[model samples]
Target: MSNTFPPVDGTWRNHYLLMRHGHSQANQEGRIISSPALGLTGFGLSPRGCTQLDTLLADWRWARPQRILHSDFLRTAETAERVAAHFDLTLTLEPRLRERHFGEFEGQSDDRYAEVWARDAKDPTHRQGGVEAVSEVAARMRAVIDELERHYHDETILLVSHGDPLQILLTALEGRELSLHREREPLAPASITSL
Candidate 1:
């Protein structure tokens, strides 16, 4: 009675479980701030976020995760903590799993950020303002996944991370480009996508 997300071509052999963080303060306020920038050591989850884990655990749909890797962000860590406790698994933090370095856009609202975001995509190597390109994030995540493929072929690994990077990685895995990311559907908070 397990659920299966058919791969791109309806093939099923390798399994990669990707999950977005649960609700967070920034998430509640609809902001793009990162935990490190704000000095929130644990990626503080909001009350709704805390309840997300409770709901997830109560549901039987969540697969018992084996190896756990998550972003160091407070939101991600908070979500991982709940999952780890429920499964008694150790959570691994990879800085590479952190959210896209928003650079100049770190604390800005959507309207304020959209202008630069448009230009940023044109040349993904834009790091002058401490910003990281979507390409670099994809490369890093791909590096991690490639290594994981070598070490855990045909095995399941859960990577709990932020929206942008996950979207980037998924695009690369499918041999697509980042522009397609915006066209991609939004991943729900605490939702899981199998690839």
Candidate 2:
């Protein structure tokens, strides 16, 4: 993976924007909600999140997205919907963009994420607490881009997802060690990063 824009070798046919979903109810509650059973339907954005999207769209400075693809999770779906509505684009659900599964930590305090990430720094493949491995998350996240590259061209595509998966994807795209993903700057809720 090359960090340079346009990929330096013409590998990417589409401009990509990775946007993390806005602050969620789960975020306000400070709980881990990575299980599909919970994430798919519940924990949608908070009032602040809606305001964030409204403010962001009112400003609308990034490259206009031609397509919007997002995780089916409620928070992400809601986030994508806001952007799609703003740009008059439709949304396509992409399950691969779902939040990194937190396994046994599901429904626990969000503070437990630090423990999992610390383990990730030591062993990217370790599945402590049955959490999805960092390397696995990176691979799946990369596959999303690879699949998009195969079918799209000259289009700015918006990918709305959760924080950890996006961070892992960005780290992988930079050709960096997966174990160091947490060392990179954290992606703020409702923020967009171009790839």
Candidate 3:
């Protein structure tokens, strides 16, 4: 593993920007909505999330994105749309960027995430409570980049996803142990990290 931004591997072809979806209805309600059955349709951005996106677009500090790829989840889709509209670009729905599925914790109190993270620190592969394993999340998230590398080049791409998936992806890209993903700085709603 390399400590480089694009990974020392020759696979990277485009600049990457990782953006977590804006604060969502689920965040406002303090619930976990990881399942596609719910996330693909409901749990879109909250009023605060809309404000966050509006502010972020107004500031627009990072490189303008030539392409925008995002999770199909409603929250992420809405977030990507704002950026796409701001930049006058189109969006590509990337299911691989979806939230880390929390299985038994779906629709549960958001506080339950702490329990899963505690277990993730012990074993990245553990599926305790039926939540997606840290390694699995990292793999799928990386696969999104891998596929992008195969098809795009010399472009600034924005990847809009959920908190845990983006965290796991960044930790993997940084060549760190997946079990330590939670140790990375938390990604605020509508915040972007260059990769």
In model 3, the worst 10-residue window by lDDT is: 1-10
Off by over 4 Å in 2: 1-11
Alpha-carbon lDDT of model 1? 0.73
Better of 1 and 2 by TM-score: 2
Put down candidate 3 lDDT per residue, 1-195, tens digits, no spaces. 112366648556788888999999999999999999999999999999999999989988888899999999999999999899989998899999999999999999999999999999999999988899999999898888888888988889989999999889888888889999999878898888887
The lDDT, on a scale of 0 to 1, for candidate 2 is: 0.90
Q: Model 1 segments beyond 4 Å from truth? A: 1-14, 39-43
Q: Residue by residue across 1-195, what tens digits does model 2's lDDT show?
A: 112344635567888888999999999999999999999999999999999999889987778999999999999999999999888898999999999999999999999999999999999999989999999998888888888888988999999999999989888877789999999889889998887
RMSD of each: 3.3, 2.4, 2.6
After superposition on all CA atoms, how large is the RMSD of candidate 3? 2.6
Highest lDDT model number: 3
Order the candidates by TM-score, highest first: 2, 3, 1
